[model samples]
Target: MHFVTGGAFNGKSAWVKAYYHMEAEAVGNWFSGYRGDALPEDLHSAAGVIVVLEGIEQWVKELLMEHDPKSAQDMWHAALEKWLQWERGQQGRVVCLIGSDITKGIVPASEEERELRDTAGRVFQDTAAVCERVDLIWYGIGQQLK
Candidate 1:
């Protein structure tokens, strides 16, 4: 799977969309979303392309707070690890991920903000292990990490 990750506003989504459109036109198939919240299940059926959003650490932290605030960090780790294992079980296919930069938020003055940043960094590290290709984008430049 290909991972498109970088700091905020790096245009990962735009890049993904452009690739999807170009691929669709070249093959005459519809691009769809699968495996994430942004798209529907019909995407898995079309077979052209599937692009999905991976959770930014902040979102995971917020979810933990909503579900179990006392042990949010532990929960985020367990949940994310489980989800990654499940995704890996899908055999072989191109899985593209869009992620946010969580480390930059460490400067926030609130406890929640700190936790979000930490959680996000951890999530990114965990997901990176599963990626076959990692691209870092900065100011419209793409750098391959894998």
Candidate 2:
């Protein structure tokens, strides 16, 4: 797995695209939460060698809406494991998870919002811990962290 993170309006998506060699044809393989795409339950039948899950923060928010914090965390780990399995099943397959850095903002006043914010950090950590490569995008530049 590969993880990419940065603040909103950063070049995360573009950097990821070029780094992964994702051309225009790669659009079909991209599942974006920004467009209301659901969290992937399975990718065994996915066609692309690189699977891109963009706007992961939105997906995390959706997950938190249905489950408690702990359960949501577990659910994310489970999904990551599933994606790992899928990636390992093929020689060239890769899973790319892109998330916005939500931890830099002020703590939200609403308990629910706060959970989402905190969980975003946890989610990024969870991904970073297992990812083969981690990167941060800033102002259209990508710096590798792993």
Candidate 3:
């Protein structure tokens, strides 16, 4: 699994598409009304294919707003665990996770917003720890982190 992270409009998605020889449609928009308890089952079929999971922070924000903290955490952990499993199972496939870096700006006054930022940061940290490669994009340039 490869993790591509940057601020909005940083060209992470474009880089992933070109790097993997994938069209825009090949990238899964996981944040498109994607409120769910489990990771999409069809991802299993993505084996030997290049799949990009975009807007992961959006999904996490939705989860946090819709559920209690404990429930949201459970769902978040489950989702990450499922993704990790799928990534491990992909022998010839590529899984590129694209998320915005939300920890760079000023701290939010609202507790909910702060929680979302913290959650996203933690998720990104965990994902990067296990990913085979990690890239941090800034001003359209990718700096390899792992």
Model 1 lDDT per residue over 1-146, tens place: 56777777777666666755544322222222222232222224434334344445445655656664436545645644554554465664355666767686338898877766766676677667767778887766778898
Minimal lDDT window, size 10, model 2: 20-29
Say which prediction, candidate 1 or candidate 2, comes out ahead on TM-score. Answer: 2
lDDT of each: 0.57, 0.88, 0.72
**Deviation in Å, model 1, residue 108 alpha carbon:** 1.5
For model 2, the local distance difference test gives 0.88
Write down the RMSD of all candidates, one decimal each: 5.6, 1.1, 3.2
lDDT of 3 by residue, 77-137 (tens): 6766776777667466666778888888899999999998988888788778768899998
TM value for model 1: 0.64
TM-score of each: 0.64, 0.95, 0.81
Top-down lDDT ranking: 2, 3, 1
> Which candidate should be chosen as best, given lDDT against the real structure?
2
Residue 28 lDDT (model 2) = 57
Off by over 4 Å in 3: 27-42, 45-48, 69-71
Better of 2 and 3 by lDDT: 2
Error of 2 at 99 (Å): 0.2
lDDT of 1 at 117: 70
* C-alpha lDDT (0 to 100) for residue 108 of candidate 1: 83
TM-score of 2: 0.95
Candidate number with the higher TM-score (2 or 3): 2
